[model samples]
Target chain A: MTAAAASDTAPLLPAARLRAALLADRAATLTQLYRRTFPAVERHVRRHGGTAADAQDVFQDALIVLYEKALAETLTLTATPGTFLVAVSRNLWRRELQRRGQHPTAELTEAHFDELPADESEAAPALAVLDYVQQLGEKCRSLLIGFYYHRQPLEQLAAAHQYGSVRSATVQKFKCLERLRSAVRAAWARTTDLLTA
Target chain B: MRPELTRLQLIEQHLLGPATPADASAWQLQTLLDPDLAADAAAQQQLYAGLQLAGRQQLRQELQLIHRQLYGPGSAGWLRGAAAGLRSLFKRRFRR
Candidate 1:
C-alpha cells in the first residue's frame, strides 16, 4: 500500500478543519516521514553518545528546522528524513566538538552514512558526557531520564512509575537529577585535570 | 542525613530547581548558609544527571520494541486485510 493510504493522522486545527474544499492533504506523508526517518536519526545520534532523549530532541529540532524551511520554500528534502536529520545532528555535534577543543572529524562516517549527505564528518562530543551519566542508580536514573531526557511530565511519570502523587514524583525526580549533575560535574573536573596534564 | 535538613527537604529544593517560578528564595538562602547541605545538594544533582542519561537509553529500547511489534512479520495480516478492503471498494464502485 502507498504511504498516503497509511493510517496516519493530521492534527486538525480549528480554521484548518473548516476548510473542506481542500481535502487533498495526506497526513501520512509527514507521519510516514517521521516514522521512516526517525530511526536512522536516532541511531546516528546514539552513536555520538546521545541517549534516546537526546535523539528525540535532535529529531524534533531537525524537523522544526525542516518545517521552517518548508514554510519559506527554501527546504527541499531530497534526502530522506533519516539522512537529513543525521546531517543536521552532525552539524550541531561538530560545533559542540569545537567548543571542547577537539577535532571535528571523528566517528561521523560510521554505519549510518549509507545514503547520507555527502559531507558527513563528526560524532557529537555530548556522547562522553552522556556515558558518564549512565552510571547512576536505577531510580535516580529513571527519574532524571524521564523528566529531562524523555521530557516526560512529572504527573505522567508519577502515574507510570506508581509514585503516590505528582509532588512525590517531582521530588523524587529532582533527587535523582542532583545525583546525575554531580556525577557530570565531577567527571568534567577530572577530564580537565587530564587535559591540563 | 544532615541534622538541619532532611533528605526529603533537600530533594524539595532540587525539584524547585534553580530558576523556577516557585521562588525558592528561602531554600537558596539556607543553601548559601550551610556548606555541608550545599555539598550534598551538589552530589544529588550529579546523580540526577546520570539518571537522565540512563533513562534515554531505556526509552530508545522501548520505542524500538514498540515499532517492531507494530511492523513485524507477525503483524503482516494488515497487508492482506488492506488488499481485501481495496478489492471490495473497487467492486462496489464499478457495479451496475
Candidate 2:
C-alpha cells in the first residue's frame, strides 16, 4: 500500500501536543507520530531512488534529530510533523545520496531545505564526545546521563541508583561528572599531542 | 573528599551557578592559581556537552526500540492493533 494511503485515518497532531509528547519521550506518542509521518518520509525516499530499507533508515535518523531538537525545546515547527518529517527526510536522503556520489533528480525549493533540520555533521564533535562517554562504565554512564542529560531529580536518582540519600546522589553525580571531564580532557590532550607531534 | 575533588565539586557548583559568592571566588582563585585547574574547568564544560549527547543518544536508542517493536516483522501487539484500526478506518471510508 502507498504510504500516503496508509495514513488516511491518522490525523496530523498539533505542534504543541507533538512537542510535549516528544519531550516526554512517550512511546505511544512516538508510535502515532511514526504512523502519521513515516508515510511522507517513505514516499520521498522512494521517489529519490531509495528502497524501503533506505527510507526506514533515513526516517529513523530524522526522527532522532527531531527528538533531540524537541528535547532541547529548540524545534520550531511551521508545518505539520509530516511536512517537517518529509523535509528532514529529504535532507537526509540528499546527504546519503551525496555520500554515495549521487545527486537527487528532484529539486527541492530553498524554503523547503531551509525548514529542514540542521546538518547532521554539525553534531559530529558532540557525537564523538559521546563515543567516549559510552566507554565509561555503566554506573558512570547512567549517573551522568541521568542527572545531566535526562534532568532527573537527585532524590529520584538516589532511590533509583540506591544511593544513601539525595546528598549522596548529588555527590556521586558530580564525581561521575568529574570522571567524565577527566576522560574528555585526556582524550583531547592525546589528540592534540598526536596532531602536534 | 581530597582537596582536588573538593575543588572539582566547587567548580561544579560554580558552573551550575549555585555556588555562594565566597565559594565562587574561591573557585576562581583556585583556577587562577593552577593552569591545570583552568583546563579542568574547560574540560568540565565539554563533559557536560558530552553528557547531553550521551543522554540524547540513550533517548534515541529508546525511540529506536519503540520503532522496532511497532514496525518490526513478526510483531504483534498494540501497535499491530493500531495498524489494524487504521486499515479498517480507511476501509470503511473507502466503502462509502
Chain A TM-scores in order: 0.40, 0.62
Off by over 4 Å in 1: A1-33, A36-106, A109-144, A167-197, B1-28, B66-96
What is the alpha-carbon interface RMSD for each candidate?
A: 6.2, 2.7
Tens digit of lDDT per residue, candidate 2, span A1-197?
A: 22233234356345545555543445766777787788778888898888887787778777766766654556778877677777888887887777566434533211122233443346566666787899988987988887676555566568779999888887787677677667767877899999999
- Candidate 1's clash total is 25
Q: Compared with the true structure, what per-residue lDDT tens digits does model 2 show for residues B67-92?
A: 67766666664577788899999999
For candidate 1, the lDDT comes to 0.52
CAPRI level of candidate 1: incorrect
lDDT of each: 0.52, 0.69
**Among all candidates shown, the one with the greatest DockQ:** 2
Q: Residue B45 in candidate 2 has what lDDT?
A: 69
Question: Could you tell me how far off, in angstroms, the CA of residue B80 lies in candidate 1 after the best superposition?
Answer: 8.4
lDDT of 1 by residue, B1-96 (tens): 333335645554565356664556766777788766667665555443444335435643554444444344786645755787899999999994
Against the native chain B, each candidate's TM-score is 0.56, 0.61
Deviation (Å) of B60 in candidate 1: 3.0
